[model samples]
Target: MSFAKAQDLLRLALMASTRHFGVSLEDIRAEFSVSHRTAQRMTDALELTFANVTKQTGSDRRSYWKVDDPTIAQLQPHQETAVEALEIASRRAKEEGRLRHAQALEDTRNGLMLRLSARDAKRAETDAEAVLEALGQVTRPGPRVPLNQKIADAVTEGLRGPFRLEIIYSGRSDQARTIEPYGLLLGPRSYLIAKQPDRGAELLNFRMDRIQSAKCLDEWFIPENGFSIENYAAQAFGAYHDPDQLKEVVWRFKPEAAERASEFRFHPKQTLQYQADGSLIVRFTAAGWLEMSWFLYEWGDAVEVIDPPELRDFVQGYQRADFPSLP
Candidate 1:
């Protein structure tokens, strides 16, 4: 492709990417059938020439490319409609008590809107309102312990400034705690990932709603020993973790649920294999057998624990019709 053609194709790709989120070099290479070197050149061009080319690093530790300036926003009408559909999905997620996904969709909508000119934002909001009204949709947040903004602010400030924090936790008593705030996870419930008073201890998740009060302390700290929020979050099935309990769990799905089981995403770090006999096997390493059991319970008898007998016993122990008296 000629330089002018490559630039034009890139501009169009960027316009779509700006509304959707961001584009990757792989996207450019596949779309334009260009070399990796050419894709890099396109990214450089977009960064240099665009007014608000910015990067957003999500909790998953992936960087999405975006153009964030209002003056130069270039979302087409169809792109606007697609984003509106996302708004609708956000509303549905909220209604279904999936607040984490609701918050994510809202954030994406806000990011796209932030890139629009003031007039455009107003116009688009009005248009979206009408569209949503026609759809007659509504939503609400999932069940969660009510959050205390003051506590949340203290935790956020500490993490942003890379400082230590002091907490007066009303757990079992009037306990004093100091921590290095790492990351905050907003889900059905919220948690603060931090390094606590003990040195060399693993990062722990503290329920924000449980803390009585929090203060940003002057003592400085940093994420040491190569800690990344993404890596830390990936170490568990859900929110609980203990390094000692980490295990490679394997489960085989009977032929009845094999196809569905194969399609399901068990964990971010997991592997799946289809047996010659038609069963499906899945495995992942994580530190939360108790938590994992909760999710696995829903699969019922369709799954068989192939490795780590402990988890299998835990599951079977709960598969009781009634409490039987022990002899």
Candidate 2:
């Protein structure tokens, strides 16, 4: 093989090893348009050259090849940031009970890290770690997921499914329901966002832990027309939403808290205005007054509600009797 052909075969062989289902000789031939003999030569070269590469024999005695180690391959400086990102994603997934995804991310991270030695790895790692540390300092941490393995798996599986799953949900008691899943959202917890045509056409959020059992139905359901998960999630102030009850909310922050409040993100679609008086005005339109109220409560006396009487009422409702009155 020419130098270029050798490089191409090495790249192909390395990728094949990452798959649990090893690539067959036919797979290489079909993908790279190489003949059976050429495919065998590439496979043999990979096994002989790389310590991590492996060959598995199928029941038919045909051999399959896979990349035993991707991380062992050297990483360029730009690749360091990509490695750092995958590490963060893996940590996030682990916190959210997505073990399979977390593990996969870690494996990828580990493989990348292996390619670097302490001497040549210094500068790129420092830059990437700095970015990750900044995000860790500012972002509010999500709650550790409380969902069981099976329920978590079901919710994950339903995301791409055209299947209506039969689920036994519990509130006052266990009751059966059929739902066509739209997507899932992860924040403080995980929710399976779906719709039930039997109940109403409106979409609903089901807490993953509350689902007693779920089974996929034989019948498949199509996703709603023009429905996008990104748009759906953007409509909520947080994880909760009252689709029809959305209202514009305004809050004024005192100078002491204005800087901090201005730096925070309360809603996906929110705007801020810094006043000449060093105060800040935060504005957003969304629903879930109770959830909104809970957030504003965190600001204490530093933040003042300026509009939407209902939100003020909800916040006022949480007040304790005999507390110091404010003007």
For model 2, what is the error of residue 276's alpha carbon versus the real structure, in angstroms, after optimal superposition? Answer: 3.4
lDDT, candidate 1, 68-157, per-residue tens: 664344533324675678799898766544565678899999987877778777888888888888886433334656567678668778
RMSD of 2: 12.6
Give a tens-digit lDDT track for model 2, residues 196-229. 8888989999887678998777777778899988
Highest lDDT among the candidates is held by which one?
Answer: 2
Global local distance difference test of model 1: 0.74
Candidate 2 clashes between residue pairs 3 or more apart in a chain or in different chains: 17-66, 17-67, 71-111
